[model samples]
Target: MKIKDIVNRDVVNLENCEDEAIHIPGLIQPHGFLISIDADKEIINVCSENISQFLDYRYNEILGKRIDDILGKDFKETLREFKSNSLEKKTVFLTYNDQSYALTIHKSQENIIFEAEPNKVPLNEEGNLFESSKRLLSSIEDTNSLKELSQSVATAIKNITGYDRVMIYKFDHEYNGEVYAEVREEHLEPFLGLHYPHTDIPPQARALYIKNLLRIIGNIDYVPAKLYTYVESKVDTLDLSLSVLRSVSPIHVEYLKNMGVGATLTVSLIHKGKLWGLVACHHYSTKFLSQETRNAVKLYGYFITSQIDVRILNEQYEVAKKANEYVDKLSSKSLEFKRDSLTSLFQDDAIYQLCNGSGFSACIDGKVYSNGETPTEEDIRLISEVLFDIQSDGKVITSTFPRQNKGLGSVAEKFPGINFHMLDDTNYLMWFREPTIKNIKWAGDPSKAIEKDKKGLSPRKSFETFTENVKDTSKPWLQPEIDACNKFKFFFQSFLRAILTNEDKEKQRILTENLKAVNSELENIGWISAHDLQEPLRKIRMMASTMLEDQQRFQVTEVAEKRISRMSKSAERMQTLIKDILEYNRASSEEDNFEKVDLNDLLQEIKKELKETLEEEKAELVIEGYLPEVSGLQFLIKQCLLNPIHNAIKFKHPDRRLRIRIFDDQNHSKSDMYSVISIQDNGIGFDNQHNEKIFKIFSRLHSKSDYEGTGIGLAFCKKIMLKHRGFIDAQGQPNEGATIRLYFPKVS
Candidate 1:
């Protein structure tokens, strides 16, 4: 088949695809049984056709019967207790008619579902829980790398459960998974190192992984119990997301049968609120585990997920340590080269290591410099123009030549890959990748159309390797490479300008004058209002307050006391307005105070000042990037950061706690020769039409009662940006949140 056909067929229209309802599956796995009860404590619904195996009553006789009549009053009361507290799941150890059984109960909608499997296995473990947990931790810690860790986890799980096969599956960017590590029985044909298409587990199924901790399928060949109800009630459909014995989709069951797997167990690996991957264990014949063992496996997975950060940090520290030393060496060497900053970087080959791309190109002061294989000069100009338009705050912009994205792909397909970190509009450090072919082996021919019926789309019947030769793509850029590009941007921007300036005193003097801080007319007006008007406002407030005290003591009329109170409050408002203006003026001083302002230290101080406000609002503050010291007036920088964060806490969304994330800008890298900081919050945002008006002095989008402010906070932020010879911009949506980005020049 043609390449176009292969690519087109592989794409799944997830948005438009019809989803099968799993909750109303009308069946349950035969190994276990399901009993759904209504709000009145009546077992109005019974799913299993044969219920005598585990319980004493018949499934046919359960409809319209009270749950207490079958499961006893204690079980009924327990269900009511969990529901009253709005809990989702409850597990109880009980004896029904003198026979012991473990019942897993949960309330869904107005009804309750009780999934019961005869608790056949004993609570006694095959091994000591404390010792097993300790050993698992030791084995994982012994691994030196991520790959080793993956293999070790598979082995540890296999040793714990003795499953026929165990595999550590990792999800890629697109949700497709590969068996990164595997341990299987000697007699089993290895499915090791095999890739699985996302169609094998649809997007909906993937989302369910996060809701439930573990899923088990016992005896794929066993008959499924059917659900039935005698009441004529129009009971709404149930949500089976947390059902332990929820019946599997027929298509998924068929896919497992094709692989000759009798039963399977899956537990999710969640990290940073996203599904990282899964630990899948398959048994060749019908297999069951005690509840204690299931809990152990869950604890093991949770432990591994918790350790992911430590593992990543250990790797990053090594890379960042080397990058740091290399950058320092380059900065010192650039001063000695006695050439343009970009020229020094190219001559020493420092830019190549930033991304490890096939080639390096630069547009320094409107002149192009390049090394290694690259597109034609005209093509380079065209690609650069497109990237420059979409550039973000102050970091490297990266993109692959996608064949599907209509907006980016149109310009991107002309080259293999592009990653550029711009210092300004005319100066940039660009990396390019030479075109290469990707030889990928799919489990089944993804190009073939999936089977569909009245039920829904089913998984492919075959699981054979099918190779596809993908063309015109370069080696994918990893996250670390992108991070390195971001770091490179700051180093080059700062050192390049410094070296060029220090080369000649005359040029340096001229550049200084051009960027010299100048107070704007707005600052002068604000300063006058703050310095000249505050004394009278304070006096007015004090006099009014004193009059109100005297009126109350002298038994004055109610109207007179109320009038005095209003006057005092108005004076208080004026006093607050004057105070805000004074702070704005303080931030507007046009002093060229060039010193290293360690942003992390500054941020800590800011957080401490806002601690009370943040605590009241239940705010969560997050810092995502490495904040470096920049050359600026320290006090003004502090003011710039403080106001926006304070605003975020003040205007937080009522439905959710305030989440404010501050990170260095990665988009606008141009000759302004500065770094931008972005403060984004999830709050009640205003329309972007008022974005500019928000920075105006005395501008108020909200009344004082709704959000108390003098409206000079952003004005103060804008002035600080002006004094630093930089810029600030605001973007927001009604009720969504806002981002306030302040750019500060890195004057070396």
Candidate 2:
């Protein structure tokens, strides 16, 4: 049958063959026919090229004939075995008459069918071996990680040795072998990270590897002849076990056979006269080797292993150099922050200013520090103790105390956090924060467990199983590539630092300009509140004084009392306007004691403060939903809500109640937390044209006579929101109540 016809199908009848003689027509032309005999050498059947070819002998005559008479002893035995076995379909390779044939046997109820074909060997005819090796070397040389180098070495050895599979088998401290890298003929599995038991390659074999450095097994099944020597009747014994180039041990071959491997070539990767690892090559089929080929491959193996050694040195140099650069930059950034000096100016007793940990302080030496509640000396002492331990080992360390330790180092135990690195001999860089769910798992295989697993499974199975095991277990390590990329971190950090520093300076300049503008505006408002508003009140006082003095001549009447009441009302309106302006100014000023305060708690507090106002207005400050937790000043957020909610109640269009709602929006940036609080009112709303105007101080659409007080409430709301790096906007028609939309950013 053709190879394609029998693919994926079961072969039948070959399992039991009664006839000794079988027809094998597909053999070599000179041996076109095959004759089979039973164990007694009796000719059971004969197959010829044509019916006439077998005409010379009748079927009864051939059946009783001794097959060895014509077919020879070897041919008879080969045929006898074919008819005796129980394999339904059999494919076996045999060398007969110096020709190799892939003989396929099929059996039927009445007869046996045999087919034969030549098996071709693959030759390295193109001499692409050196080119393949060179390409592999070039591809791997750029790998800057030990893991990457291991993988590259495994792949290169596979190509150079022409092995079906090759692996970089590293020996652990316990002498257990691990496959750090592997390349296979099939893509079915990976074995790069499997770990195999130490017994796979026994202790004696491992020790021999350290001394010999190179081993080549040409044919695993080959047996060496016994040697005998004598000179002048003196005999000398040669210990084959001690010879580096001696043939492989028979026991080792049996071991491999038990594991199903036909051939293995191992090149020891020696480091300091010990076996660090092996460039292990495996062949599914037996391999034949020439002395010249063996030596050449050994020399090539030496070159590749040396490359790995040198590459590791280069990588260490690179890491140290890059780390030093970043450390220096961090030092420079800290000094720069200190020299700037304005952080002190921005400090307030009630606020925890992150002067030392805002920008550069938070980002020095790959650690981020932030301004929050200042740690106590006790906490600092505990933190120093932990830092001492981490500095010694350069690994993550943590400690904790009950009841929320307030000492300096308590932050380390207070939160689940990770930060550890070698900064210097005396100073180890580290970051400690409360752990969140985000830190428990990250998007990386940093532990390299996958690489380790493959190494563990390598030597426990047959060559096929080992090959398949490796293909299944190997995991590519990319961190070295990523770590190498960190070489540019100096440039990146410096660039970012420069941008941030310049921006800070620019922001200071802008703040100065803003402060000037604000002062000017406040001065102008001062004039309105002091001079303008005062003049109306002064006129009312003078008019009242003159009227009282001339009361006898004027005969005090109801008309006079009404006129006086109108003038007093206008004066009182001016007083209220001045007070609103002062409140709005306070909201917009940058001098507030800003600090972290729970937004939810602040909102509740504001509700309590405005309880009387809300009750009197018969307005339910519904607080429609849960308040969002945000980082801002407690007092400021209280003011933010107070102005808006109070306005909602104060301006209620006589027949309606006030309602406010709060919730968080998830549409913000990944790192930002955004909360929106919308305060809606059933109050007398203004025209859309005045939406923008209402936010300005003293800008009012309704007269004091129509409304109760000043228009500064909305303006104050806008100021407080802006102070928090937030915003507020109004929406409504002239008759409908307004909805003041508030957006509070999650982060500053």
Candidate 3:
């Protein structure tokens, strides 16, 4: 159905669904018996209809009885000694009537669940878990691609476990899963590429999958064993999330029965500590895996996950390499039109590769550049107003018009594909995406999962090929498109800064004038609209916070938690951007109250502003010796100092204490008309070749994982220097440190 319906209902709606929860089923799989004991170490709960067969005690007598009363004194002491090791899965077995019984004890939500299964089959003492693991590992050792790896994984698991069918199910961003790979008997109908809605595996079930990591059901049609407990047991329901023989949800069992599946086994494929996907095994008839074989499959899952990670990294590297090559080509073509840097800072082709569009537009300094089938200048200004209204985490906004998504409305429809990359806050890189109508294939009807029935609203379970011809929508911007924007934006901005940050005074003066001229329009409009736009973003952040705090009350489970966390992070980023925009506007203002500024006083003010951050990072800021007074804008000087110093702390080396040493020997000036101040930090250093480019606006070398920032700090420092009629420069060696030297002219 519709995404909005699913978004609001997926977690909150608790209609009778077999997948939602099974822990409190009040029943157990007939294959085993379940008993829960609280802190008092007495039998507080039971679910076995045949407790006598396993424990040789009456079900009613077991309630409120200690283990000694049920299994005798020596066995209770043996259980205590077994539990003292604090192992993940503790076990002890006893032959109660010439029959071997296997007992497993594991703690769940502070309550210990005692599960005992009859060792129905004769033990094969010769079976080797390690040998089974090695065979499984060797089966897929040479797989190099995801497709090959997935195929190998499915085939190997099927062969090792002897299941009738094995499926490699992978999850998407929205939790919807696709059967990526499958291996089954040749006569069976293929479900190779079928997709399953997220409703099929509700929040509680997915959470259980994450907790247990492996699960098995011996038979779908077996009757559930009823649990009996004292009326004063205090626990109305047992948290069977970690139980190996937890009763399968009745609805889930029915769903499986409908599909003609008899038994099942599944293992989680985890990547970077998150549930990535699963290896779901199905049988046409009743089946069971030996404990040793189960352990072997688990170990095999670990290697498969690692291989998946490796293949993903390789694919990403390939994509990035290709994008870099494309950027280099775009840069080469752009040089032809940038004949004169002063007349046209952007020849309209500068951002074309960065934004794959039929038309391109750029608003920077006070200048506007446009080419191809772009919106009218007035329309561009109007669209830019809308662009300035919304703030995003990545400083980029994209929309597919057919969905009637937010940002630039009819303007996006006119072009079909629209992307606005905020250079800072006001200035942007805009592209008009040409429309191309095409048909999309979905594995299911894609209707809302919830439907009203005779029993009221419930999840719909119809999956069929639904085709819809999407119109007025350009090709969607994939992750690669996003990477393209981020990568080339870095390149283009660095190119601009390299041209501007020159030592030659005449060239610098010419370029600085052009920079201000091209970007002045954005600065003017941005200041007035900023305050009004900020409140909505704050409201959005507040909503996210409220939802997260009340998550449990509203039944916002793991699924909604992830989405809300992302929303919170994005909103926080937006707020930071808005504030940065405000600071930047004020920092760039020409109204100069240039005065004798004491360097020591400014540093102290900044230190006060960053006190909490300094304490958190455990960083030390050292000012060496006496500081010289310079004639400069106090606010402008603060902007210069604030950004660099903050960055020094932000990118501190995790392994060592951060040290930022400010050295001002005042040795570089020959005529006393200029004095130099160097801010040095022993943090992640960059290559010397990129030192000049790093000062450019939005120039960043490391990704957010290595370090996170909008890449506007040093750019502001450069501008603040240019405002003071002084100079700022930097020198760095990779992994050593970086020194940003600010040359304040008229020091005397």
Candidate 4:
């Protein structure tokens, strides 16, 4: 047939090769013959065209024959016995025309397939298969590293199969193949350390390798024998996934031929039910292994696969042991320092080495802290925004090629790799890796891995070494390293939660104390309503009754007028008490309305509201140094300053004029973090021992007749300061002056 005709007939082009139905190719290699029979009727349904070469019958004669009539009742009984059990495949040797053949039987969808090949090796070799596997496993178990294990496997397989060359090919995360270890003849060129693009083995091919543990091509140049179905049968295509003699893809055959390989064998190394790598053998000339030898090799591959997980975990344990030490150190340091642990941890070089990172950055409580090498603050912010948008449920995110992500491409040259974890909405941690230039050696130019020619699509023909330089990528993060990062995240989050819990406990304690104080104040209020408030009401009623009776007897007199004047004063005092109580209630229940509040502006407003009172008291209010801006409720802050200023005028010393000064506190050192403003008054002051008690609700040091006040003003100011997450302090000296200071936390 013409090459073009053959290409069109069977070759799957690269464009659609991923969807190729290689499992049901309906052809078998010429070295072996295949026959399939219906499971229910035991009648032949499909048979390879080359079956006549072994069965002493033409294709037509064997097409519709019963299993018992074609291969005798003994073979039928064997098939029944094999079917009764749960084995995947069963092999039995039978003598036909003075030649012994090994027939492998397996079940397809609803049919049973039998593949037969000539038995060239002695039965004695099959008896020693267990011993051979034992020695191979021993050699593999003694290896200390993955590379050593792979090299040992390659050498063992090469010595057993007598192939010209043997290689252990491992796949990367992208499914690209790398010749990890190799054993070759003395004169042959080396293929070790060469990389192959993922396109070399399409997804479909890799899937087949996972299903079938072992596959061999006896001769790559041999013709394929087409499968012939019975005239009365409905089966058009036969599934040969388990067929030992299944024909290889035309593309795969061409690939082998291009490399001058006449025969090849591949044994899958499966770990954790997934294909980890492969043991690939190549022969310079047409070669074939007996069924016994192939079975021995398959058993050896199984033992090697069993050891993979154990060895890998053993290696990772060492790394994890060291990582645990770093975690312990970090925990100790975080506990030892009461400040920001994220900042303190980064200050030590050990944190950078913990993850083998070139740079580190952390966002703790909306503050950014970084160490080692890092991008600009603006760039870090941009990256953080992208990360937060994609973050979900605090899962750790990692990438080797950060440039592939949107908005990060520009900064990827400096920060090529990143490992990130979010603690909360506003807090996160990140580790960065700098780009390290890498020189890679490929089996061929990967850029030309696939090409379209007259044959539709073909793999590259050259096997010469090709060099390429890779950039903008750091060394890929190993699984152990990533696990360590996860451990660190857990530890750090626990530390943060502990800190928050302690703060919460302290706040709760304060709240409990305030609740008790409030209960005491409510009791005092009840007493005032019963005695202090009712006293005025009693006097007004008594005075009115006396006037009414006296008016009935005679005209109004001076004594009656005196009683009326006292009633008027009593009514005024009752009205003031009710208003103060209402104001105190509003202060307790009002929600915070926080914004930038200029203290200077607030004091000016207070001055205007109390203008009449200041004038009546002849109070000299002086403004000292400028007051700074703070975050607080404007209206509430105005009230906070108004009450103190009003008190200075109300309680002035009878011997002298009252003087009040408002200014920012110059004594506090942490001005950057807090805004402390003080109000000092030169008026009648109480003993210093009553500094805290004066702010208590209804706590009066002097008689009510002397001060004419309800004592609720200072308490209201204290509540406002508490709502702003700040505090108010009072200091006083009898017959001297009093100073009250408000400490407000500066907004970030």
Query: What is each predicted model's overall lDDT from 0 to 1?
Result: 0.74, 0.52, 0.71, 0.79
Q: Who wins the lDDT comparison?
A: 4
Candidate 3 residue-wise lDDT, 1-748, digit = tens: 1010001123224464643555666667777777667645555554456677676675776677676666667568766765687655666666667766667778766567778777654255235544555665675667667767788778767766889999988887667788888999999878777777776676778777887888989888887677766666656566677778877765567567656789999898888777788889999899877665676677767767888767766656666566566666656654422325523434535355444566778776656778777888887887777657654763544546435444566665777667777776556777777778766544556565445565544444554555657667776664555677777677667665655555356677889999888768778678767887788888988888898889877789899899988988887877777777677667777687789999988888888888888888899988888777888888778888877788888777777889998867567653266678889999877788998898887788888677778777788888888888888888887777788888888655
lDDT of 1 by residue, 79-142 (tens): 7787788777878777777766668887777778888777666544655666677787888878
In Å, residue 680's CA in model 2 sits off its true spot by 99
How do all models score by TM-score?
0.62, 0.32, 0.59, 0.70
In the range 1-748, model 4's lDDT, one tens digit per residue, is: 1010001244554455666677887778988888889988988888788888898876667777897788887788888898889567888998778888889999998899999999888556654665656766788768877778788877777767889999988888788899999999999999999999988888978888987878999888999988887546777677778778988888788888889999999988887777778889999899898887887677766756777777788888887777667766876772532345556676776665677788778878777788889888888888888777766676545555465574567676677778888887878888888888889899899988877687677778997899999777887676777777778888878877777777788789999999979976985675566456666676776666667568756566778667676776667677667767766766766777678988877778777877887888888888787888888778778888888887877767889989999988867775666788888998787778888998899888889787778888889889888988888888887778788888899767
Cα RMSD for candidates in order: 27.7, 24.4, 29.5, 17.9
TM-score of model number 1 = 0.62
Off by over 4 Å in 3: 1-21, 43-47, 72-78, 87-102, 120-132, 329-361, 365-384, 397-420, 430-444, 448-452, 455-484, 498-748
Colliding pairs, model 4: none
Q: Write the per-residue lDDT of candidate 2 for residues 486-555, one digit (tens) a residue.
A: 3333333444466578778989999999989989797667756665667667788677767756877767
Pitting candidate 1 against candidate 4, the one with the higher lDDT is 4
Poorly placed runs, candidate 4 (over 4 Å): 1-15, 122-135, 334-337, 340-342, 501-748
